[model samples]
Target: MTIEVRVPTLGESVTEATVATWFKKPGDTVAVDEMLCELETDKVTVEVPAPAAGTLSDIVAAEGETVGVDALLANIAEGEGAAPAPKAEAPKQEAPAASGGGAGKSIDVMVPTLGESVTEATVATWFKSVGDSVEQDEMLCELETDKVSVEVPAPAAGVLAEIVAAEGATVDASAKLAVITSGGAAPKAAPEANAQAADGKAYTATTPGKDVEDAPSAKKAMAEAGISRDQVTGTGRDGRVMKEDVAKAVSSASAAPKASAPAAAPRAPSPAEDAAREERVKMTRLRQTIARRLKDAQNTAAILTTYNEVDMTEVMALRNTYKDQFEKKHGVRMGFMSFFTKACCHALKEVPEVNAEIDGTDIVYKNFVHMGVAAGTPQGLVVPVIRDADQMSFAEIEKAIAEKGRRARDGKLSMAEMQGGTFTISNGGVYGSLMSSPILNPPQSGILGMHKIQDRPMVINGEIKIRPMMYLALSYDHRIVDGKGAVTFLVRVKEALEDPRRLLMDL
Candidate 1:
């Protein structure tokens, strides 16, 4: 029997995708649910997995080719031929352990505990395979948890002896991942070295005995940088190549001419030269989704931004007065976000249109507020909603925001937490953004942008005084919210924030 592998649904509003890379080629055996290829869409890259354990028989779609959702990617031949091949190759792979001397010195690679709550993670990608050379501290694989992606490093230099957990496999912390044959010799350098060695002198050109005793990391680095082991000055035990030496060589390779001839006039390179200097990498699924959604929000919505300035003096004073006590009582710091969130909730209640969305030809008004708080992560910006934020106490709001922000960056947020936000608040002020009009998180009619505070002269009762002021921007869907309503909403938020007691009074 032959099984057809098809691309899965990419995401909401994502219909088509480009084949980014194929992990398995024709004649290669694959296990059930094993990832075979990656499909890159405008929103995210989706992994196509094997339908069954079999041998890859054909590739219907090639790399860089576009295909719609559920389109056939390849075929796999199952039954006898496919099933017996892996068994046949198993002995050949294990043969090295029996034949090689000092094989028992291999280092066991185990999964490290991620956190108090996390115990298991999925193997995201494997950088090196069995028999592939690796260096100590070099990334060997990536582990994906509910909240974050962690890179597993090589424990010792040598060959990747075995793989206990394949990509997409879930394992507990402290579980064996793979093994590295420490003290084993590296594989011969690429054919490029042999070409350089054609003159015979190339082999012995580097310091005598330098390449022989070089650390696996240094040797791997030397090969990648195209520098002979002898050329780099060793800084490791017994004058062996260190990872840093390889890095220096790589850095030097780019600025080689400049370093050698500092007085020479620099010349512009041609298109070919420029192309050689550039690098291309496939975007991750998270980044693609962020780009697509943000672009779609701009094209589909009638976005109008309204600005206002808020006096932060009162809010700061309140926080300064009670932050210590608040932290001690609630076990979470009193942050400015909770205050702003409360103010937005109150304003949203008064001005309901800002909390509404356009559903096809009709207006959808949400009675309950699921406030989305924008958090920046290494991957991209993610908004996790605090359900019924309007009903949450200040201490509860502070705790939820802190937990969600931490989980968002760690990649632990659930899909439910990111869905169905009635309103959003983005604080670019944390990043020193003086002012910015934030875009709407689609379907939601409004987003409040908070910016950096600065001391400016202001009149408070006929006297000029320096006060901390912050610029606020509210970007809303003009289709749903009117200019008057947008302005009125901003004013209400400002009033609530400037007078923090209003939040307590629900005024």
Candidate 2:
């Protein structure tokens, strides 16, 4: 029997991917759950796994060819190895002779279904140990997908018999994780729900004194948060703390204090070890897409940037004065972006070409503003759109932009939130950028870059005065928008921002 291997669902907004590399070829014996090939999408790389322990019979999708989600990638001949192992290991029926129990059974703890398009997860943490007793529905381990962290619960009240999947190992949905032996006594079962380890608090399957390994992303997060591994509640396989886990620990006051981590003793380097080392890693789907899109924009568009400076004195004073009442009335903090977004809306209306796209010999103009706000994340930069920005009030705009930014950092924003924006606003001010020429997000003809606000001496009515000023760069496609229109559009935004009454009175 030949079982067809199909592409699993890609994450939100990603419908298809290119076959980057094939790990196995036809006639090659592959174990059940072994990766057969890699599918590179716009957001992330997905490994296509073998459906059964068998010889690869045929390749349906060749490397570099695009294939949609659920499309056939290859075929595997079943029973090529000892009757293929089940997607999940079944519990042993026979009881061990030493353990006096009726029909000793062991149930497999398999990876649970996460959500749509999520096929596999990396083991982040394991709460229970081999020979440890666990209660049903209790969190046994945590699984980290590309987007979120999920805790795996115990399926049965029994002793953890064996761990099939270790921390940092990635497994498919419904794949075997560990074995739980029913009616078996734990060597030293804890009396309470949250009991500490007797030998040591470190929850791992490794030998004593061995340094615990963390996934690279998780390590970076932990380091940035100034947290040691033991201080975090791990959700990765084998009780390994993931990046999100550290983030949560940093946020919560109740999180554990720093614990001494096992150190790897330093050794004198050999001649080979002293040489410069290099490593190569495949670009993630998100990074790859970003590169492609930026290059495409540069190649296709007649890009030109127009610059101007804005005095933020009045806007800052307005915010400082009404921020308290604004937050109370709207349930969201007043921000500079909302003002800019509203100002841009009015400007885009005056210069419609900035909000237009080229559609193969025709120019398509949008009446309403769909604003894309660029936010940086650990994975990469993402721009989630605020639909119909022109129709929204200051409070509404602030709320929408804030929510998108929060979700972007947490990796919770959906693909729909990322698609279809008429104009983009990228604020380099938050990162202390003095000036930058922001790139245009294609299809959209324009992008507005906001720079850091600095106190500078400026001439006012022939007298020098200190004022808060910001440099703004408007990058637009010259193919659709003329230099005059672009400059006028930027000036309108500057006028609206400089004088707050213009935004309130629709000036």
Candidate 3:
């Protein structure tokens, strides 16, 4: 009998992947669920595993070649002789059973399927150590991907015999992470003591003892922030300090007044000290993708920026008047984003070219608006799309923005939440940017950039008056959007924002 190995689903919006590595070659004897090859996609790396115990008969997808979902990767020829290979090594496995107090089968703990568009992850933390007993379906470790943190659970109740992938290791889907010896006896000491021993650290009489070990990522974050362990509180299992706790501590410390003198200013490094001072760190996958896409947009589009300023006096007053009542009724705070999103949706209807995209030689016009809101996180910049924004009410728009923004910051957004955007809006005002020409998020014709509102004197009705004003920048692709259309879109947005009633009336 012959078994075919095919690529699994690559998640939402992911259609293809490039073969990265092949662990087994043709004619190699393989066990069921053994990893055979790896595929690298734009968002993640996927590992293809053997479906049955057999001899790998053929390789269909070679390394560096791109293959689509459900594409043929390889084939296996099942033979009777293949099933007896493990039985022949029975004596080698008996030695462990004699010392460990039980004769049991060893099971491989493989990486689970990461949610939408994610293919690979970094081993963030291990909750269990080698020789520690684990319960079925109990969380053993956490994997950190570009989009979210995934908790990996144990496959079955057993003793963790070996840790194949350690902390900070990048692993693909279905790759072996650890080994569990089923029905093995628990060690003499507690799991905590075993963990400490494995890490080469011990509690002493002279030193202060801690309940749980600090997470590896948390320690790195504290070092980078110049913070001490005693300053930040732990929130993880058994009072272990996590990376997020250190970040919170750093943020709180920045807002407080310093009681001590400031440190000396950095001076120019001497030739001898240059090498020691400079550090080189590899770019993360998210950062690398951001760089590539931004450059690609610049190269492909005939980008042009049109600037217009809007009077924020009306919008600010309207928000302040109804904010309390609005929040009480809708359970969401009234923010400037909802106003901008609503105004943009109104403006997009007036100038459809700004909302359209170029598909090859043809221009594709979308009647509905999928608004992309650009958000910056610790990893990099990401744009989460709000579907059918044009049809949503103010309260719904506010709720969606709040939810997606929170998820984006926490790196919990899925790929589907980031795809299918017809237009994008980026508010650099939150970071105090006065004005910036935002780049186009490819395929989309335009992006609206919002800047910080400043109280400036304006001549209105031939009289000089102080008004809260903001500069709006519309960057559009000249190929699809004419200068007139781009200018019209910006003007409409400015008018709608200056008079909030215009958005209500759909003017």
Candidate 4:
């Protein structure tokens, strides 16, 4: 019997994905849950797993192809005839069924509805060569779309037999990618979720090796994969392959059956070797959106920034004294951000114009403060809101800030977490910046930029004293917030920070 395996729907509205890479080939036996391939969207990456235990019969797709959520990826023969055909079709629901000897079967790599608006993706890459052995749940290829990257994995275990698509080709979300056949005599399929590789293991733990020489190559495979090296079953000695083994893996990647090294692709130029050429990747959806929003704020608002300086001695002392106690009691850190955030809240309350939003022809002012804090991530910048700043205590504010910060780093924050903020606070000092003219978040009238605290001598009561001081900046929508409002807003923040109790007192 030839069984068809398909890609599953990634999420609601997400229609397609891009092929990332394949982890297995034909002729290899795959246990259940063994990773087969990786898929990518512009937003995130997903792992594809094998659905059965069978010989990998054919490869219907090549690397760098796009496929849909429910498209046929491969076929698995019940016994030794597992050809492990490669799937090349991008996801399309109209795909007809292909059967084996007695009858051709339909292999379905499902069309992925990644988001409400996303209907299709471009196929990215395929991992296996025809005749190579494939294991269940081993990655086969990758797919790409507007949101993130996606991987296609082996559907079963078997030897590879076909190549479906050429590399760098595009396919629909429901298109086929690859196929696998029963492993050995066809062991009962294991649960997919429970078939994950060992934690932090050098290679695929489910297929651990007893030999020792292949150890170095296994480690190398893990590193080049960069994303899910854990998903690959190591063929190295003791299942350990170091970085040095990458050349060997690449050389043998395209050959199967009686394997032989294929000609290597042209190598990428190193910075030291190629001084003139600079390669840049395309901008991500989030980054493009961020650029548009920031430029919109600049063009739409009459913005201006004012600067001020404050001594940091008192604030430093307070943080040093209460940091441990506050953390112990509230389960949150005692950081300078809370102080600055509180200060901004107090200041915004005093200068209402700074907290107002420009809604078309009207100046809509907010009574409650929803402060937006800027957090940096590999994707770009995201500002998450600390809702109802007036109502939360210092510890609560710190806790909220930290939680949102973590979420931003993990790319787990949602759209709702980013909306409805009336003002923004950005701290460049965390990266060793002394001062910066902060930009404003759109609609809101003001933003505050915090600078590094440094020791400098200054005259106080007719005597020079060394003290830690910081510079603050307030960027405001000058159309609503005049010079007075800007200066007042910054002072309020400075005062609140200097007198830590003022934020507590609501004064």
- The best candidate by lDDT is 3
The TM-score that candidate 4 achieves is 0.55
**Clash count list over all predictions:** 10, 13, 2, 173
Candidate 3: C-alpha lDDT: 0.81
Model 1 misplacement above 4 A: 1-124, 127-266
Candidate 2, 1-507: lDDT as tens digits: 889999998877789999998988787776655668877887666776666666788899999999998899998888735344433232344323223454445666767555546777777556665666788998777676654556778877887766667665667875778766777655333212222232334344443213344555666776666656667777655555567777788888445567789997998888776442322333444566678889999999999999999999999999999999999999999999999999999999899999999999999999989999999876577899999999999999999998999988766676557778999999999999989998899999999999999999999999999999999999999999999999999999999999989988888
Q: Score every model by TM-score.
A: 0.57, 0.59, 0.72, 0.55
Q: Give the TM-score of candidate 2.
A: 0.59
Cα lDDT tens digits, model 3, 200-221, are: 4442111121535465557678
Using lDDT as the yardstick, the better of models 1 and 2 is 2
Between candidates 1 and 2, which one is better according to TM-score?
2
Candidate 4 lDDT by residue in tens digits, 354-398: 889877789898999998999876556789999998778788899
Clash tally for model 2? 13
C-alpha local distance difference test of each model? 0.77, 0.78, 0.81, 0.65
Tell me the RMSD of model 4 versus the true structure: 15.2
Among all windows of ten consecutive residues in candidate 1, which has the lowest summed lDDT? Answer: 190-199
Candidate 3 runs further than 4 Å off: 1-82, 85-99, 103-105, 114-127, 133-139, 142-151, 187-269
Cα displacement (Å) at residue 454, model 4 = 1.1
Q: Rank the candidates by lDDT, best first.
A: 3, 2, 1, 4
